[model samples]
Target: MPASDALEGIQACVFDAYGTLFDVHSAIGKHQHRLGGRADQISLLWRTKQLEYTWIRSLMGLHADFWKVTQDALDFALDRHGINDPELRADLMEAYLKLDCYPEVPEVLSMLKDGGFRLAILSNGTPAMLEAAVKNSNIEQFIEKNFSVEEVGIFKPDFRVYQIAVDGLGIRPEQIVFLSSNAWDAHGAAAFGFKVTWVNRFGQSKERLPGKPHFTIANLLELPNLLG
Candidate 1:
């Protein structure tokens, strides 16, 4: 009954790292020189399958941490996208660890932190991976914590992962505003009782999901404004 009410009393803004705070495509594109003409296709397919595997695996009750799933997805995408070099996979993954933040992210997050709202990351990434990405993107300063689901041995859409974030941070689920780039995860968080904000960077049309976001924005640039 008081669903969007989650947003009204938000105490902290927690984000999904890969697509929400970091630029996934830019990370892939950085491998363009090595990936040659297939860079874009390779990057997109890998991310696509990476997410697909997580969804299917969650549904099938098989669990893999995010890093393994990222590689498996990369393997699948490489084969389908005509890439065959083992060295290239390493290069691409190295780039993933170094993804740049969306240009607007740093400023908006700074505003949020300066305003005394808590800022944090709750990701499916390994702790090291999450840390590396955040450091590379220059987002570490604004965040108070970096939380990984790996500690709890699960990926998202499982509800338990969100609970880990809530419990680990010692915050009520309703006090945290969960920001995600993936519509499905946004749906999952909202259904699980966190405030949900969908960063619809790619202009995705809303599809039916169990629960919907309290607010949607084109980028983090608009986030601070929306929060107020």
Candidate 2:
């Protein structure tokens, strides 16, 4: 639990889509039997490479939408694991579009919405990808906007990427409560000046980064209480 004084003057709640609100591993979980013993490893590698590609591409000035990056990452993971089935690859990619929300997501978002805070998602996902996931998870009404990196042609950790939330919400960075399950993303949002909360769902260690989160909570269930 966070100290009571941590979050203050929060006008909006901006969340990272994957891992924060949605279960990024749910796609792989659906095919666990088929993936067999390599399921966990492939999923982990896929996610790692997915984020790595985004950062690398951002630095190289060769931006691709998250969908493409996800596909490429899945390909790499599959190849590395010696699973070369085209049907399985396609199924995994399709599954990414409909990833499940974390069990407490809807309840937490509703609580925040009932509390009168504006809500939005600032994600590396494309508009289409975000839309499908939000709609699939039935959380569309809770989100006012889905801010994608496509608008800026860059992935996250980029200062410009964080600016989308500020610009879209028409608020100062300090007024927004940014939440992300990724430690690096929490640090990035913090560096960009948002009042950050690292939703440390997987118990990841805090990154040694320029910015530090004001609070760290195990899950979104702790969010409404913290904000209040």
Best by TM-score: 2
Question: For model 2, what is the alpha-carbon lDDT of residue 197?
Answer: 91
Residue clash pairs of candidate 1 = none
Instruction: Provide the lowest-lDDT 10-residue window in model 1.
Output: 1-10
Any residue pairs clashing in model 2, and if so which?
Answer: none
lDDT of 1: 0.85
Task: List runs of model 1 lying over 4 Å from the truth.
Answer: 1-6
Task: Report the Cα lDDT for residue 110, model 1.
Answer: 86
lDDT of each: 0.85, 0.93
lDDT of 1 at 4: 38
Against the correct fold, how does model 2 do in TM-score? 0.97
| Candidate 1 lDDT, 1-228, residue by residue in tens | 444344677789999998998888876787788777877888888999998988888788788888889999999998997768888789888888898888888888889999789888988888988999988877788888888887777788779888877987788998998999999889999999998889999999996989888888888887777766
At residue 200, what lDDT does model 1 achieve?
93
